[model samples]
Target chain A: MTSAPPATPVPAGVRATARIRATADGRGGTALPLLTGEGPLALRRTRGEGAEAGVMLVGAMSAPLGGDHLAVEADVGAGARLALATAAATLALPGRGGAPARYDVRLTLEGDAALRWLPEPLVSVRGSDLRVRTRAELAPGARLLLREEQVLGRAGEPGGLLRSRLTVTRAGRPLLDQELACGPGAPAGWDGPAGLAGHRSLGQLLVVDPAFEKAPAAAAVLGEFAAVTPLAGPAVLVTALAPDALRLRELLDAARRTYGW
Target chain B: MASSLAALLVLADGRFPAGGHAHSGGAEAACAAGRIHDAATLAEFCRGRLHTAGLVAAGLAAAAALGLDPAELDAAADARTPSPALRTAGRRLGRQLMRAARATWPAPELDALAAAFPRGAHQPVVLGLTARAAGLGPLDAAHVAAYESVGGPATATVRLLGLDPFEASGVLARLAPELDAVAAEAAAAARRARTEGTEALPAASSPLLEIAAEIHADWPVRLFAS
Candidate 1:
């Protein structure tokens, strides 16, 4: 009888990694040559528009609990296009470990490549602590459209500790680097007048296009709580705050339509 | 390090001709939107600004005073600031402050900064370089930045809402301890950044301030420039 291999023991908290690599096919379409997922991070290929490869993030189990370490990396080669989305909102919950969970996302785009990262909002539940960091590196002539949203808490909860940082570099130069801290243990007055101003939901949409180098986006307020501004580089950033997640997505969607993206 | 305390006073003075008086630090917009009216709301606004924007500005100033590259620090400041209107305002104020610094304390670094930027660098960068030129330490620069973060808005609130001057000043006075703590934290961050890199500096953000500043810039009739 053939002996079955011993099952690997899973760690206490989840340690997951998801990787994706997209390359351009000869016929002007994109193909994912590599797609890997481990532990709770599951990656599924989905149908995308012409010339673009779409990947949907599917959670295989309840993960990213306190003390969990999750990482996702995506690389788009030259002339390739990729779209990434999430199946549902990620909920950060307290675990037995009581340590802060960490989620890191790294993206790389080669020459003339494009990436659209549209993930669902991350909800910080009560008594949970989560830190998320996203870094994107783009080569010359590359384009990126990234959207991130955070819902402070669920319906009647005050939420837990959440810290998020986004850093983007193009051609090895700094484009945008910002960090937002909310919920418990953040700086004082985070929800005060100059911070969220009593708003619960916050999000940002970043668009980096080489074409913006010529005709940059004009600085304008998109709504009462949303404003669009051009960065120092050839990019535009839209920041918005709302009372809830649905309204926050509406604001960002409206901004997406404004740019026809 | 022994330095001229009077120089710190002069640089931190609200009456100094650095064009800060023309900017409300988003207080004007808050008042217009009714987010800040009485002294209580004003205090809350100032505290929020102090912790987020104030902390970031103080770190940059402290790093610059420690003799970090002004060009790199300016770029870092640009990366931190996501608003074009705020960027313009910062440069404009930097230009104005550069003129004042050149007259007050002449330094080759300041001259090089002015020549390199031509238009101007970010104000906190210029402020830190000015503090260096004045023979001040990084903590001094951090203190000046922390003070100015709340001072501008406090002064503007007095004018915008017609709040009691004593109350406005009291609000600032009550924030003295927090200001000192922020300045200390900023100076420490700057020290770490000096060795580790500019990424070590704080990047705390105030979204409402940024959003309101964008809307304020488009105001046809506004008392303040930002």
Candidate 2:
């Protein structure tokens, strides 16, 4: 994959929308963002309707596998009402890549806005080491819903080192966070027989709803081996585990079936 | 006027019903695997975690206490926490803290923030808000931060070490001075603009902790979430 010169940080006002919905090709990638960053992929929320808007990062060009950091400032407008959803990012990666590439997604929710994130699937290529970092905030009564997923390899293909770290916090506090560095022959956390029973691609979904958490329904929506937990009266936490990539997608579809319009 | 002592009493209560008991502070697994042993080693572990995850996370909560943008605080803490299990642990604790704090303090804004960040926020942020709701100042908020970040594991060590529970409580009590000192220093440092990154909260960093946490993630019979 060819790399573009570092991505120049544009001024906050009226930055053009960057929306690339790329898919994974056998050799490397397709339609990924062909660009460079002064340092890494950074998106700062200059301003927007607290709950009505959010910046989307689409990968049109897949760059060399290394460490990539994506920083974001997400503001969930206060008491904005309607349940906004954030799509869980779905990335397709090959395992053969040398070093692990780290991806960090940071969020800040203010006012009374709500957000829900759901993505397709995150596939790690053979021998490739991958890492992901995510941080999100939930302001007062701002409903935040999210699902994180990862696959060892593409359907029927080889998979390798796919390490990752995810941290989620509200009001600068920690609700859910973890770091994993796993490779072939290593036990994937929460995938052992006793953990989640060897699920390959898994997800940890966080839901903030003042009314009913309804964890049972959330798991059914994901359609995989998942555990759901209730927290803080206005919060819901779901841990979904799958045996492979396809199964993980099935679960995401299930979640949409249960909670989405 | 809600006294700081009242807030502390509620926040630090072992049976306050925040589900703090379900967690093993990574100490249980680490100890079971021989990663930590005895009080000296436990002290070492707590100190390391204080700077990395604890300080950084609690710092964000302190920002929230200062009325800094909650979103910024959440993002910074998110950037700091990298583990999925630990991430899950943070959100769970944060959620419960918000729930219990709301019951005691009952602020509309607190309820709103709790709803917005249900699963991903950390414990310090909740403490910051509850401290405010409980009529606590910056110093009191900082104390809550230090205790939530370290006290969980210190208590866990008591069970793991088979040490007297009273001694474990004493160890935590001894930390009061340190907690007070750090909270004071952090409050002093937080007197800055919202744009400035506040790194003085509470955090703990240890590669072994990371490795142990990762290993624990794969355990089917693991005791704690992190």
Candidate 3:
């Protein structure tokens, strides 16, 4: 009989991997889950009331200074539902050789599955170079709600550098594929009228559910600070930038509460 | 060298009448937001954009000049431009550039792109294909893309901030060396892309520029389209 490999210590600075799967219970609901990982990567699932029941946090596998490589692969089976969140703000610090830290997330949603990735802000302190790439594939009727917030640096301090790329697809067509690269000189253009218009913090939220209506209203209300762009599918991309992280957080949280996705 | 370089000059010329005059590359918004107050800040802004968006666009143009697939390059451009407003402006610029290039150069690939996009493709993709039609190489395409990346904004700033046109020109001149380096790197990447695929192209981005472009789009009255 085949068996899972025994756990081993993951060296520092090495990539820690996590895979979580949520399958249909078949009796009429989604199953609990099957999760595996070691090191800085870890997963915590919570059984709350109704929609909050499937919320989970996939975070760093181990404790390290910085420059930890972590991968999270999440699969939500048909008719399954999962709301994913980050345990805390990811603090990116200076690496050993000045190399940036990295995080890679891959999510696949089967037919009729839903995943809400509402992670907290990823704060990049001075001298911190961080890169995050998130790729998601959705079945014909699957749904995904994802958000990414970046704080250039701590309050009153300049941010280091951050490069983030997000690619989302349904069936074989591209719904939304976006990349953002910012660094030490971020405030120059971003703080300008043509760029973030002087905003330091930026937030990107993408929703692919057909039934999600609160976005349109919320987007319309946010006006200048936020702009909503509709995709080919029922999806919509809302991007917002603020002068500080607190304002950006408030803008995003307001949308989150209003949309309730 | 003179003939090919001259053809590139014409394409990169601000007065080429390709609708480039309508867009400021987010400079108008930046100026109004007080991000660019003088020649020094303007230079800094241009330099910042040069390495990020300029580099990315130059790489794509070079790749396109190398005869990479238009659809694939278009998708790459789309992936790089997160702001929907910027995407629309890019295609609009592409359509305008297409009209001029078809009239001036006349290439089968350009025709194919016009047919496929009907609406339009991304600006960098069209720029590369236009360079091919103009008998220019990848380096020339990269130079054109890199130059336009700052040229448009510099001119727009001149008009928006009323900064001295000569000073703005000076900023562009100061950025020339870096622009050359970016174009060279873009050309190198394009050559590599011939074998390594479009993923070899740079995806450097400016999130502030992107987010600002979206906000600028919603302005009830704005001088530039994006």
TM-score (chain B only), all candidates: 0.99, 0.86, 0.97
Superior by TM-score: candidate 1 or candidate 3: 1
Best candidate, TM-score-wise? 1
Q: What are the candidates' interface root-mean-square deviations?
A: 0.8, 10.8, 4.1
lDDT tens per residue, model 2, A102-145 = 55555555654556565446667666656666667665555667
Candidate DockQ values, in order, are 0.68, 0.04, 0.35
The clash count of every prediction, one per candidate, is 0, 104, 14
TM-score of each: 0.95, 0.47, 0.86
| Predicted complex 3: CAPRI docking category | acceptable
What are the runs in model 2 whose C-alpha is more than 4 Å off? A1-261, B1-3, B193-204
- Model 3, A1-261: lDDT tens digits are 589788764444766777888887776656656787767666777674453336456555322235677778889988887877777877777766555678888999999898888887888788777778888999888888888898887888877777777877778555666656676743234343334445668997777875643443322426556766555456767678788878887877777665547
The best candidate by lDDT is 1
- Residue B126: error of model 1 in Å? 0.3
lDDT of 1 by residue, A102-127 (tens): 99999999999999999999999989
Where does candidate 1 stray beyond 4 Å?
Answer: A1-12
TM-score-wise, the better of 1 and 2 is 1
Q: Write the per-residue lDDT of candidate 2 for residues B1-226, one digit (tens) a residue.
A: 4456865777767788877877766677657755457665566555545434454555666677777666656655554454445656777888888878888889976887877886636776777777777777666676666676567778788877786777666666766665666666566656553545543333333334433454566677855666
| Candidate 3: Cα lDDT at A103 | 84
The alpha-carbon deviation from the true structure for residue B96 of candidate 1, after best TM-score superposition, in angstroms, is 0.7
Candidate 3 residues lying further than 4 Å off, grouped into runs, are A1-12, A48-55, A58-64, A155-157, A184-199, A210-224, A257-260, B1-3, B188-200
